[model samples]
Target chain A: MGMTFTSNVLKDGLSRIQREIDAAFDAQLPVPDDMSASLVEAMRYAAIGGGKRVRPLLVASVAELHNGSREQAVRAGCAIEAIHVYSLIHDDLPCMDDDDLRHGKPTLHKKYDDAIAVLAGDSLHALAFDLLASPEMSNDPAVRAELVHALASASGHKGMAGGQVMDIAAEEAGGDLDLHTITRLQQLKTGALLGAAVEMGAIIGRVPSEGRSHLRNYARDIGLAFQIADDLLDVEGDEEAAGKALRKDDAAGKQTFVTLMGAEQARAQASALADQAIGHLSAYGSEADILRELARFIVERDR
Target chain B: MGMTFTSNVLKDGLSRIQREIDAAFDAQLPVPDDMSASLVEAMRYAAIGGGKRVRPLLVASVAELHNGSREQAVRAGCAIEAIHVYSLIHDDLPCMDDDDLRHGKPTLHKKYDDAIAVLAGDSLHALAFDLLASPEMSNDPAVRAELVHALASASGHKGMAGGQVMDIAAEEAGGDLDLHTITRLQQLKTGALLGAAVEMGAIIGRVPSEGRSHLRNYARDIGLAFQIADDLLDVEGDEEAAGKALRKDDAAGKQTFVTLMGAEQARAQASALADQAIGHLSAYGSEADILRELARFIVERDR
Candidate 1:
């Protein structure tokens, strides 16, 4: 019954973050009453529809555990999700992956052409900062500045952008990238933002630096687990559930966890990671129950 | 003699900003020792090289008038210039303007491929915010937060991105957009960043909000003048000097200040605005001298 209750709360937590993120976009980024309407429309198109909401869930969960304000956590969630969506739009461009579908619909580039899509992504990136800078996110300006800095460090050249460059180079070079390098790349590319998400919640709660380290450890475990799960999904995820192209990494000769360690080992590693991630939270009590369940769910989920 | 002295200071001011901005890029964005090297190279490709360095100059000039720290001003200048360079890189994307060259060199997309170009631009955008959030930019965290907020407001949907949408829409609609709409478009597209440059400089100096209005007015006037001059350059500038395609705006049949007011009238309007812009700084004595000269030069410059 205790496990069931926590799972239910985790489910609600996911949906709540999704709703708040959607509303945050609508409330903050209204469609302009002119030709700029299309730009906002494309931003809305990318942001609103659907995703797993994992990043936001992490933010909200950690914030709640620390007794941070719900509204602030929700707003932070929107900010991180905006960065994630913007990245996907850029990633799916014609010169990038050139994918046409996302979440079972035509990608922004496919639906609205390339120019609008580019501006839309650029605008969403701006919106993330705008949201974080707002009073809704935090009345404390220092916290706000820290959030902006952390997000940029995670998402910019030093982090996601840097990792993306390495990803592209790996593909162009055409060989099996070493496991160590692949792990580092994934840490920068995906893990940085994921770590930022948890760190943001810690900031929201005013968690001490010593306390923050444990959260960071938890974030790192989940981040690696999430990516390993993604690699596993690509290999075996159902097309309908996954809602995007899959198994392309192997076809493209890209290095992935599954490729380096084999599918079975990768799955085992993901499980170990998820368990360790939950272990880091042992200090937090029942207040962190939802985070614990979510960790387990992340490795087990099909999509 | 006073006017000549001011002009010389203005010249050194411009060169100082150029050198400082180039050095800022070098110092802040060191290339990693991996595949990310190419991404940093692409970012360098776009951010370095020749351009007027107008935005940074505006920032430094205004900052100096307010007695802001020179080091702080140069850092702020780099932040704004980072945003400007990022904008150009995105603007030159094949899906947008299809530009092959910029500042007499190959565009990022042309030189590094489209994916690299997009990520480089995105990374630079992130770098701009990161720089603003840097400790070197300010010791006060609140000031850093305000800088981030102001830059985002000026560059985001309600600013550059919003203006870009209307511009594309104006072309797609295929008609003479009304003068009112054209003015609004340019305000968002070009004017916003120019205004932000001045506002940021004022912030760097810790100028009170009331003390900042004159700078705001000065910025507004110069922003309009800058765009009109750009329109003039398109009609009459040398391809070798301008370092990019020109006359394309007219060829595209888009609504522009020059098109609406005629080249002669547009030139006159630019001169009038430049005069008004200079007038806004009568309060600052010799400290304002460089800003006044810079305003006049903006309209008179060939490129």
Candidate 2:
């Protein structure tokens, strides 16, 4: 199958982000000796292995738009991805989601035992903040502090972890959240960090306030649209896709946009949000093609 | 019920530290409406409820020696306690230590669900670096960044979490470890953060390099002594107490100093280290009384 132009650009950007991220994790995570070999391996397995690399793409794309340092943006992306993977590791614990598989492989706990999984995830969380504040990320202490503050806010109780609490509550309460409640939950759980990705790019590039607002609007729309696309993918099998599609949400008894808005309407809403998200980048002109393409590519990818 | 002089001073100092910490936790961890009410409440439950507050006291005492700001020292202490409690929460998880009780109360996971416990622990971890970089902790960006760096190093895979991985490895490997390996593990898992607590106070107080090194040496001694004392308590109970004494380590199938070195030898070692720890404060004379008393108290506390 031939790749479309948008898909090509997205693929190219994602491949670059993956390489940069892999290197960042390698340089950042080293097993001290045999004693910590398993823990480091768990960290490496969870972090450096293959995935979509969407968050890093967003970070790099936005940072590029504002003329930020690519090296710095990649570093920031590594930090963001570290938090994302840590959350996933903990979420997949037997006492939590109990999932045995992630990224098409056995979960860390399945491979290394639960205690190692917990410690690795915990370490990754610490490493994220460490990377954000490190000299490698930014020599400017204020920028480092800002990154720490912002990333912490996005990942803390009021953000992703807090959102997880609500998500679990929603599941236990029979998966019957109204659209508004679900939106708020998703905003906290998923959207906060996505939006922070864009915002951090702006912060690194020293984007002006008005410019940052526009980027944030872009992130907000794309973040929600992305989750909706995910929900749609979950409800309706990806056409010609292998194994990942279908109604796992139903199995998990999750309340998602597709359940609330129907697949057709959810798909339409996602498209409209992508269009509006692209519109938010009007000032960036052709320079924002990657972002615009990314918005469109996110919902359309089969895998 | 007449208090001994050492107890009187320790009690007065602890009372003040407890009050300050409670206030910090209250002001810092607010449940917003209802969404994260459980998570925040759980954080309060694990953190603000009650503990020895020894970490905070160590931070305060060391900072006081260096003439650091009390408000700042207390805030830093709160951050340290948050990490300590988060570690405790995760450590007590069923997949980990499987402890049902901590600080003489039901553990967070036992009291709530595992998900809530994990999220609460994760949130407290975030709150820690957030608090460290916050204006309330320090107006200087360098100090804030230094703090974020130091605490993260102490908490990351190389430090507390790494130590935990080793601890679990030790236990799962039939609790067999040479004294040196176990000592190294304790240094990473427990001593690192404890020493960090002392070093952080020095950082906050802007202690000169020589003085900081001295404080660190003091921290190192006390840190190891504290663990040995804990092992002693585990084996022999509080020197003058009962019911908690003997064979608990044997039952837990864990190798400890008392088990490896014999109870008498362990007790002597702790006392010698405490003496050495106190010697590290020779430069401070009268100002070091509480710190000196704290070294003795750590090994001697009835609880």
Candidate 3:
């Protein structure tokens, strides 16, 4: 019952990716022997503080599904994670989201000063590309180049940056957004990088163009689904479990999927999206079962 | 005597890049009737504001040298310039350099609030990558990928970020820095993108590896030389001529080549580095002479 199918392999892959991510983060700033001890320790504390390595795990799982090397995928996964953390640091700034709780502890900006948090975020963003361009991916410069391009596109404008601008504009504009507007907002704000995560793994794995499209579609669904679940979690999630203050969106008067669609429809939409995402796997035979399950796990997870 | 031989051709190339950059900045925005007018305007202001267009010109020049289409190189050059502007915006933030002036005008933060400046900087950064990954480069995914990778590496840590970190650390520590440390910092801070500009051009043009290496060396030397001259400008430069505050580095107690090496030595070093940079053009024969002139101009210019 436990070990019959290859689905069990995903757990191992996740763990390996977790280990690799930790190693990579640790390796990111190797305590410049001459630098201030306090600064180094603060950087380490900010980086090592816990979060579910969901994004990197997504990359590893997708890479394995493509019959690509998990090792390479994990490296890219870590790079994405680094970028995510960097963004989190910046988002939590006094000028930005200004959150105190992160990963069940004080956020980087809360723990450190706003300046340190800003620098840390900036450094981490830079490091993400450094990790991608490193010798680890040297075997195929083209793939490495693709990874960088995809991540940058997703991380920068027309993706995350655009989404951020939208978020800022929406917050300032102070009106109920149409459903289409909300969808477009979330797609750019969150879906861009999540979609890129899947697309990047496929690109690095050398998946065919059509396969790349399928994976991208799958990622788009799950990316939005992930955000929707996040919105739902914000309304109903436990502070301790979610590792941050819940109901932030409600407090901010932000219009979210849960707010617009209502909880029941949102849940239904999440389920529908998960099903459609899993259906994309039909092209890969049974090898994509884990990706299917992973989608379910994303929408279903309490955290 | 004023226009000189080949200056006309180089000016034409620069003019084309400027127009394309203006169009790219205007056209590539997210299409909706009502976008953030202020943000868009800020982006346009930051990007379209008159500058030397040195980086893009380098890209176009290097592309032509390699028999690559100047159109392709122009795209890459515009993207790099966007990144450069983003850096300038961020660097001028209150938490960073706290500058009031840039390029003879009020800095972004000076003109707007700190928050908008930060957002503008972030947006420009993202837009740069978006431009790089645009359909023009997308036709050859591999080339597009390489362009992304090159810009990311130079812009991110181990390049610009590393230099910034060193700058902050050095400023905070405030010790007599060794020649090696100063060189390392400037190389990362300024030289990285300068190097990236030339390399990005070569990559877009599909120059051979040897040719790319030569251009990189050329860029590396000029980049450092450019910074050395900047240091000199900060020291001995007049307010009217420099178009910004003069001797601010000394006033702020920041370390600079002029402060460490003295004005005369800094100028001498710049001249030597400029000559070395021009020497890399031996490969280009006559084609690279404009680049050589550009390097000389960088060091010689009062502004």
Please report the candidate that would top TM-score against the real structure: 1
By summed lDDT, the worst window of 10 consecutive residues in model 1 chain B runs over B1-10
Summarize candidate 3's per-residue lDDT along A71-165 as a digit string, tens digits: 78877887888778877777776677878988888888678666566666766676677677655765776676667777877876566766777
Q: What is the TM-score of each candidate against the true structure?
A: 0.97, 0.95, 0.87
Which TM-score value belongs to model 3?
0.87
Model 1 lDDT per residue over B142-164, tens place: 88888888888888899999999
lDDT of 1 by residue, A69-164 (tens): 888888888899999999999999998888988998999999999998889899989888877876556778888888888788899998998888
What does chain B score (TM) in every candidate?
A: 0.96, 0.93, 0.92
lDDT (10s digit) by residue, model 2, range A1-303: 123425667778888899999999999988677477788889999998666778888888888987889998999999899999999899989888887777667888998888888888999999999898876778888888878887888999989998899888888777557999999999889999998888888878888657578888888898899889888877665533623225667887888898888889998898899889989988877778889888887677665
Which pairs of residues have clashing backbones in candidate 1?
none
Residue ranges of candidate 3 with Cα displaced over 4 Å: A1-13, A27-49, A133-142, A212-214, A282-286, B1-17, B34-40, B110-116, B133-135, B138-142, B204-207, B210-214, B240-243, B282-284
Kindly report which residue stretches of model 1 are placed more than 4 angstroms away from their true locations once superposed: A1-6, B1-6
Q: For this target, which candidate reaches the highest lDDT against the unseen true structure?
A: 1
- C-alpha lDDT of residue A84 in model 3: 83
Q: Residue by residue across B207-272, what tens digits does model 2's lDDT show?
A: 865758778888888888888887777765642242122445567788888778998888889889
Which prediction has more favorable TM-score, 2 or 3? 2
DockQ order, best first, reads 1, 2, 3
**lDDT: the better of candidates 2 and 3:** 2
> Which scores better on lDDT, 1 or 2?
1
Weakest 10 consecutive residues of candidate 3 chain A by summed lDDT? A1-10
For candidate 1, the lDDT comes to 0.86
